[model samples]
Target: MANVSYFEAWGMWFDGRSTPGNDLLGLSMIWWGRFGKILSFVAGAAVIVDLLGPSRLSRYSDRLTGFLARRTFMATAGASFVAAITFLWITDPIGMHRLLQSVLCLTFVTAAGLLVTAVSRALPATHRVIRAASRERVVG
Candidate 1:
């Protein structure tokens, strides 16, 4: 019989092999999973707040009502999609490539929605910085 180390007998090989291009996908999926929960919670809270009288979140004057509605729908759908994929993939990893494609699609949509929201939130600060720089250039 060939000599086997203790760790090898125990199946604890410390090989440093990795799946290329999978790290980013794995991290992105994790973020999406967490962000999905947050979005769902926010959506639930928004609905509760709306139920209460005169809430600021559902105000229609600034078009935030429509914006929030769309995002909430998208987030909920994406979360459900991710959950379904996870369940099916866990049951059988044979079709993991196909499952990953589905997950990537949902993650990309959620990421895009988040990116747009972030850019919109930063617009005022960005404008302020530009105005301040322009004023300094003119004055100096």
Candidate 2:
């Protein structure tokens, strides 16, 4: 018989629901889902470590710490936002579907804004190089 969709199975597993099925695909889904959780835990731990200050083992710890320290608020806010979304999504909170949808939209917009900001910051140096190269070609 047909089984639940992969994503559905993943969601079910995440929220402590029953397993997908007793088939190979269900086993695969469970394995990947558990792997995803492991990855998420590692990422969360990394963020916590970065927030708590740099490690002594890394050579570039000072520079990494400096960057993270400068944007601590932003980093914490973004992490909290992600955690909240994950919790709500898994818990299946009452009447939160619309909120989750809105949050998803906001996330896309925030990602776009960050992308634009990064591009804008890099453009000035790029433009200067292009201008200088063109001038050199024209003169030489």
Candidate 3:
């Protein structure tokens, strides 16, 4: 087995071939590599959410944001595992693999965007306030 980065793992998965070997909970290289890609997105999203402000969907507590993030992440992880295994085992591996990969990539991008929005909301808005302070100091 060659050392592959997370991005390279996606290449291995979508190369229109499945390799032999199990690195992820007994899943073969194809499924494992795909799983790695999904899991990385899920984990990275969770971390970003954890570092961000409270969710608008919840009021008065950060716990709600954390809870929802955990639930959503777990749900994605579970669904990805089931879908990957189902497609790899019971259906056409190549077609299903591509489909699942696309779905996961879409989900990852959406989650990252949401995380960015949340964190941006927590950032201190300095443009107007700083400009006003500078004007006052200059005038005085």
lDDT tens digits, residue span 31-136, model 1: 5457879999999998885575342322332364345445665655555566556656564555557667667656665665566566556555555555565567
Ranking of all candidate structures by their lDDT, best first = 2, 3, 1
lDDT of 1 at 8: 44
lDDT per residue as tens, model 2, 1-140: 33566576667769997664423354554565688799999999988856654233232443445565566557655655665566557546555576766776567556655654564455555555555655675577
Q: TM-score ranking from best to worst?
A: 1, 2, 3
Per-residue lDDT for 126 in model 1? 53
Task: Write down the RMSD of all candidates, one decimal each.
Answer: 17.3, 17.2, 15.8
Summarize candidate 3's per-residue lDDT along 2-114 as a digit string, tens digits.
54555555665699544444343344567765887999999998887566523321232344345545565554455555555554454444455677766765565556556
Candidate 1 global lDDT: 0.53
Off by over 4 Å in 3: 1-26, 55-140
With a 3 Å backbone cut-off (N, CA, C), the pairs that clash in candidate 1 are none
TM-score of each: 0.32, 0.30, 0.25
